[model samples]
Target: MNFTDNLAIQLKAAGFSATTDQLSQFTTYYEMLIETNKYLNLTAITDPHEVAVKHFVDSLTALDDKDLIFKEGAKLLDLGTGAGFPGIPLAIMRPDLEIVLSDSL
Candidate 1:
C-alpha cells in the first residue's frame, strides 16, 4: 500500500482518523525530510515504515487529549523538536493550532 494507505491504517488502529489530503501532506513532508537528510543529519530513521511509525505516529501520541490541544487557537511549543518531530506532524494534523517548533542546534 501507499503511504496514505499505510498511514491511514496505522492512525485508525490508534483510534485516529486522517483524510486523504492530510495523508498526502504527510507524504510530501516525508519526501522533503528524506531529501533534506541527504546532506544534514536530520534523522537516523530513514526507512519509510520506521518514519511513519516512529516519527509521524509517535509524534502524534502527544495529542492524546485532543479536546485540550485541538482548540481553535491553541498555542503549542515543541521544544527540542529534532528534525521537526511532533511539531511537523502536529501542524499537519491541526492546522488551526499555533505551533512553534524549536531546537538548540
Candidate 2:
C-alpha cells in the first residue's frame, strides 16, 4: 500500500473520513512541507512515518470535541501561526470554519 492508502487507513482507524480529494491535498501539503524543510526549520519530525504519526495524527486528536461546539460560519483567529499548526489542520477538517492565521516578524 502507498502513503495515501496508509494515510487513509490511519485516518479511518481514528474515526475520521477524508475524501480522496482531501487526502490528495493532505499528501501534497505534506510533501511540500518536507521539501521546504530542506532549506528551512519547519518541523523537527524528519522521518516520513514520524511526521504522519506525530504531526498529522496528533492534529486529528483535537477534532474529538470540535463538532460538538462548532458553530456554523464561526470565525477562528490563530495568533502566531508559525508553519500552520492547529489552524491549518482545523481549516482542512472543518471547511466551514473560517480561519485567520496571523504571524508577526
TM-score for all models, in order of appearance: 0.89, 0.84
Worst lDDT 10-window in candidate 1: 62-71
Which parts of model 1 are misplaced by more than 4 Å?
66-70
Residues 54-105 of candidate 2 have per-residue lDDT tens digits of: 6676676766767547686888887887677767767777888898999873
lDDT of 1 by residue, 12-70 (tens): 88777888889999999999999999999999998888888989998889778656556
lDDT of each: 0.87, 0.76
Judged by whole-model lDDT over C-alpha atoms, candidate 1 comes out at 0.87
Score residue 12 of candidate 2 by CA lDDT: 82
Candidate 2 at 55: error in angstroms?
A: 1.4
* Candidate 2 global lDDT: 0.76
